[model samples]
Target chain A: MAWTNILTDLLKVNYPIIQAPMLGVSTPEMAAAVSNEGGLGSLPVGGLSPDATKQLIRTTKSLTNKPFAVNLFAHNIPSYSEDDLEPMRKLLLQLAAKRGYDLNAADLSNFKLYNYLDQIDILIEEKIPVVSFTFGCLDPDSIEALKRNACTLIGTATCVEEALYLQQQDIDIIAVQGIEAGGHRGTFIEDMPLPQIGLFSLLPQIKKAVRIPCVAAGGINSARTMKAAVELGADGVQIGTAFIGTEESQAIPSYKTRLNNAKDTDTALTKAFSGRWARGIRNEMMNEIEQAGIPIPPYPLQNSLTAQFRKLAQQNNDIEYTTLWAGQSAVRTTLTQSKDIIRNLIEGYEAL
Target chain B: MAWTNILTDLLKVNYPIIQAPMLGVSTPEMAAAVSNEGGLGSLPVGGLSPDATKQLIRTTKSLTNKPFAVNLFAHNIPSYSEDDLEPMRKLLLQLAAKRGYDLNAADLSNFKLYNYLDQIDILIEEKIPVVSFTFGCLDPDSIEALKRNACTLIGTATCVEEALYLQQQDIDIIAVQGIEAGGHRGTFIEDMPLPQIGLFSLLPQIKKAVRIPCVAAGGINSARTMKAAVELGADGVQIGTAFIGTEESQAIPSYKTRLNNAKDTDTALTKAFSGRWARGIRNEMMNEIEQAGIPIPPYPLQNSLTAQFRKLAQQNNDIEYTTLWAGQSAVRTTLTQSKDIIRNLIEGYEAL
Candidate 1:
């Protein structure tokens, strides 16, 4: 397989590597560093306001003239009230106290979601070339507006069904997030029961089912795995955990150290941190929350409530308190430069 | 990677394919068929007595003079009385009656576990060429005894930790069973918390961590998957569900049909069927048992108790009443000959 495939041509990158759209961790500098290196770089403005998102786009644009992608959250609003969140809040407080950490009670009075419509408007206003959707599919009107401009629309899918659904909506690219991927599962039908399929099984099946370009995302943090993905039928490879270990990534020094120190057995999926099931390094806070077995609040809300605790943990360099988002192949993570990471992937695969 | 690797050289096989030892379904005919096709075939005499094991060896030998592997269960005996099993037995009976099936009460008095020591004696006396183990690791003396008799020893592992353990015990080969694999997990440390890494990530890491030949076994029934495994650094491949749908597979007609009809989400892990987590098509009996939240007896015992219901379900061709043990890739199963499956794997990988 050649490197100059549809994904590389469309993205105008020298290599078929896309920096994963990791919210909070993947900053403008990291995105630019990869984009400058001739690989598709991504900035996740999913958790930010429209104004903040526009500012991020400008920062990334200033850093590098090369093409870059910006991602937004399209998850459905899950139902929950004060009562539903009460038990989880109390349990978290108890855990924090037990661990000798200073934690404040959650204030849900200002718990409004990010306006994705406004986000779409900002992207169009900023003339962002590449836009991606995660958590769920974008509404048809949002897709149309993005398409009305010359934006390449990428949708995240966890299974073949989701890929088919994306094709029906005329998605330009499908980012296949295998079960081995770190962070949140990008399942559109949140409540529907579905099996977790790996990228190797998912890529070939999705390629057979859909005509669009597929970018495999999950446990693909190395050159060997990158080559395996392309050989197994992936158009390109999207990497996350590998970048987290890079010096250019905004991940805290301790966070980077913990990720590098992690064994293959250190991670598992848990819904305690964000209500939606996500793979992360098992920590005291998450483990305690899982043990409590309290009814969790929905996504975004659950994520907001724990933001303060995570921030505190980061400030104290306590990896045992915050969620360590890494993939099943976290052991493959190496601390180096972002551009060096991209160079290694291209060189490794090409050498093979 | 050539087929002339350590695995093929050690096992004296043409292709790097090993038909997984499936008890109750893998017959002498199936084993012979696979071996005759230039791949290593395996017979699971895990649940049988010493006399029965020898008889099966003779039958397989008579069918083909080619090399084949015989497998056994090495699980520790869990303490459980008849009273401990009452809840599951009653729950299954109620489920059976509700489903309008004629089911027999389990006779628990004849529940003497297969004396593995005696079975080992029979394998040595009968001059069995190859013996494999699952469920748990064998002791040092047992490994030494098998080695003393000039018998090749293969150990099953679900993770890198287990693979390292197998290497320490002087095992000949490590059958790395990924999480996507069907049948019971070959976890050695049942009490330890372990991550379920898929074969795509598992194979490459295990190959780096251990010098012994690693056989990739999990959800690898396709040419694409087989090629993916080899490309990912597996010395050989062990497949189970792909062979189950064949005419020679002793799986019932409906079981074969159900396997063919399985979708990506059709199967999941359930301790309900055998009181040990195994992936299978979820049925009424299994569902009811899972919902009952009852403590059940351990393996070999729980497996014995549910034998009558599974038999009755098979007799009636009622898929909802029986356990359909297949991998996540069961949807790819084809109703061909055993030799045809091996041919497809080699030809598919070779064609690539």
Candidate 2:
């Protein structure tokens, strides 16, 4: 049978690859460039305001008018009391001091990161063709609304149990996230274990358990792996680290430099950047945090508290402090234009 | 060129696939079955006495006269002062007491492991065809001696830097082990940060860095993955956990049951078993060990201390108290005859 899905046919353009919706790093220009190259480009609105999300989507549309996916965080918001924040703030200050930074509680008190409820509305209003949710499934009402808007809804799952749950929720597609996926794990229902499942084992089991169209993610940076994913029963592949260095990405030059120099063995998951665990280049800050033996508060608060440190770290070009999100294949990532990357990927896939 | 080598041609194996020599679990019958089915079978002699090694090799020869390898530990013997043992013994007594066992300092003394020097002589006398070493390289003198004995020497490397070091030692083959490999890491020279590089990333880079033959290990257990490894430029593949359930192996019935029922998400690495890290089914012993926070001595010594507990745990059929070494593909393993396991592997390779 010929590959018939929208994603499969679309993949025919510049390889059956999709640039993952990497929040904070993916740019409108980057999305457009990938889409222009005939690959599915993704823009993550998880960290953006609704109005900002709409404006960004409009900007991307003006640039290419190509189909792209917008991603959201569907994880339930965990609660944190004021009492929890004070101790967490103290912990962060102590951690920074260990790294030779003088920071007091004032530096963290005004931190702000409200969830993007408006971004999901804009995706429906803008009639985006695809919407993907990570961490957990969205409320059934929101999923139904997005489906009514003609958006293909994709749910992210870290295990077969989660995928089956998503299937029962009636989502159109499932992103089978192997443990190697960079950034925060999409483990909503369950607290994922450390160094969770590898991709090879995770893919076939999830495929056997669920009937929905599957897209494999995590550490898939090469054309050979992309083809292998399809052969192993994935309809398409979603890649994040591969696009971190594309010319159109908003990632800083320093970030690109770190990625370029990364060895295949360089990446690891650390909770230092945000309180939630995410994979990144091991850095001085992570080493200090690991040794600190202090408990971090819940997600957004911890994400917000460390936000200034990360920004300052990025601006100073001090790689030791930055959150360099990447997979095990970081060393293979090339610094080039997105169009060239897509072209090479297409060539690699066809050669296979 | 068609795949042709001593390992490939001798077994009439189209591809070089060798089941790793797991000392405690890998049996002579297991190695023989793999050899009979056209793949290299290996017996890990790290934990066996020289005489035991001879008997194992003899048993294997009786079953299948095909080519096989013997694996050894090449690390220096762990040293501890007389004072060190008293503190270590006292700590263990407290742990045993918590587990409802009464133990004294006298209970901690007698532990002996097979001497590698003695085993090497036995293998040399028997004219074994292949020998592999982990944790470090065999001495240059030993490598030269083995070569004179017509034995192919394989060295394990955990990093590209280590791989380069091995190439200089003039070994005939190199097994590139990533962090995902089960059992003690093969890092011989220096303790490097865990690379966490999956087979996809490690295989190609090692292929580029070293001119010697390369065998890919760690988390590779599927037919599709085996094909991918060859395509990734590996000359051979070494698998361990995937063969755990075969009838000829020495894994306990309960351990095999746990492995067969394991999920892709089940296995995890913790230094609780031996001072060295290993991946296996997480059990009560692991949870208690992590919580107790008792410092473990460096390996071989720590490995020696745990032997009594491990033995008792296994004899009592209490899986919770034992160390069950398995890789991520434990879920896909089956309780079949060893010969059938090798037969299915050959069929899988041929089908691919």
Candidate 3:
């Protein structure tokens, strides 16, 4: 019944629970708070520049001596000319204009896509103890570099085949994401539709196939869910939506409020926001895009196009227009501090 | 942790496991074998005639003296003219012709849809102890008639709202079907897409809201999954896919072979086979319908149209053309006797 296991020993945390590195919401303060409270706090640098990643890691280190993780986006950046993005750009502009937001062509342009390779040296130099990546696995060179630093590498998988592939590539651990997860899907397999296996079904199969520790991600917010994941043979639980409403999270107030008020059925998967499937609370923007039946451009292209529009919506505190990323268990989220959240998890599990 | 909870006590079973009433695959021999092994066996009469239902119940009774459940489909049959069925009928004919199966117009007609209301009296008169239903709830008159006989009533729910509704109607137990469940979805709420909440997310939410005993269904095949469900507060479990490969199951040899060979990602939700959404192994027929982007006629209509084609394909043992209903945990299934499957489940849970 004790939480101590291979994952806890490897990450050097008291509990096997991990705060998910949510790109738009996770903050240095949040990661430090979790790590300081004996859980693995993750710093999401998936969308950040190397300088920003360095600054964030330094700030987190200043706040806590406990171990933490740095997360990166390892997906291949799609090649596209400016002309290829014109149609979606015009559509986004028109949509923004209808909402009384002034978004120009320049607002959607000039966005640079960062490769995970560019940020590897920062992790190695900073002596980051843990590194996790989603959307795909890290390259061999980067893996070798991280391995040289003795970093505990975690790769995210949405199915058994992906978990096997990650283990074969020498990942130290695998974070198996379920369909109930929020944000982007970690499916990297090509020529197939997205694998939407839930945590209950995906965990045991992945555990049976892989030798490395497997952490269950998605829909794990409470101690009951955590224990359930453990019962299904998970080494640990990677929690996201539970921490998104915490005081230290950088998620906008409107997003937090939506998370607080949402129900189990309120969240759904949509590719309209970034052209990659992600689970979030359904809103006007998602509904409009789906109703219009327009084909969304692939990942970074669509992500870049919607950048300014999301920013403006966030600034205006518009819940309907901004991306309100949350998992299916958003109803379990509470707006509390990070330390209290981790404490409640541990205490709840112990009481059970 | 004892399996003797409110559910088992109410249903007069030794264990908290219920064999799912899969419409096409469940058989009296299978149900009785499970009942004889101290599990709650279920005879699925959802698509059977009143005479057939009575015969199945009598056969099962002759095989075992233990308690079992009879399942019914309670949805309103759509009122469609013969003209409404012509186009879909013609399409099925063309598809069957391509597969070298001879079919005439008369072969497709004369398939009668049975109303659950017509089957309630049979249960009352036969003194059946347990009745479960899916697709929708039974009418008030039918409920009163069954309750008058002191029969235990179980209703299927795909979301918390549906679970709450079932509780309000005084259902003795709720078979909370997750998106990972096979066969037809039990979503009855109007103006919404099918609620695809997985067991990991849906179980805790439904358990928190309803006062009745909740039996977790969908993607639960092994002892680990069974324990996971119990940890998440399910009073019992209703298993389906685990029994598809049983020697007593009425599933075709090709279907059982496919189930034995399937992985976690092989099953997907498709509304193409029937008007209503159901999970099954992806086949050429599903791909063809999806690729053609044709609007399938609603249930019973579409069910009738494709009935002959599925039958012909099964007769020829062609896996590609038959409906292979399975849950996400199909990989865990094995070809064995129903009694052995129950014994393995009990032993597995005890070992854990």
DockQ of 1: 0.57
DockQ of candidate model 3? 0.85
**Residue B243's C-alpha lDDT in candidate 3?**
87
Q: In terms of lDDT, which candidate is stronger, 1 or 3?
A: 3
Which regions of candidate 1 are displaced past 4 Å? A106-109, A332-334, B106-109, B333-335
For candidate 3, list the clashing residue pairs, or say none.
none
Error of 1 at B108 (Å): 4.7
- Could you tell me which 10 consecutive residues in candidate 2 chain B have the lowest summed lDDT? B6-15
Instruction: Name the top DockQ candidate.
Output: 3
The order of the candidates by TM-score, greatest first, is: 3, 1, 2
Per-residue accuracy of model 1 over A1-352 as CA lDDT, tens digit each:
5779898887777887899988868989899999999998999988688779889999999999999999988886666677777777777777777777788674433566774776898899888888988888889999999899988999998877888999999899999888788998888764557558767667777887899999989978777787678777888989998888777776778888888887777788888888778888888778787787677777887887777777777888888878789888886444488888888877877787
If scored against the real structure, what TM-score would every candidate get?
A: 0.97, 0.92, 0.98
CAPRI-style class, candidate 1 = medium
Candidate order, lDDT descending: 3, 1, 2
The superposed Cα distance between candidate 1 and the true structure at residue B205, in angstroms, equals 1.4
Quick one: best lDDT, which candidate? 3
Question: What is the interface root-mean-square deviation of candidate 3?
Answer: 0.8
As a whole number from 0 to 100, the lDDT of residue A18 in candidate 3 is 91
Candidate that would win on TM-score: 3
Deviation in Å, model 1, residue A109 alpha carbon: 4.4
Candidate 3 or 1, higher DockQ = 3
Candidate number that wins on TM-score, 1 or 2: 1
Per-residue lDDT of A1-352 in model 3, one digit per residue for the tens?
A: 3668899989999999899999889899999999999999999998678999899999999999999999998888888788877777878888899999989889988898887888999999999999999989999999998999989999999999999999999999999999999999989997787898988888988999999999999989888899999988899999999888888987888888878888878888998888888999999988877776567788877887888899999899898787888888887455489989899989999998
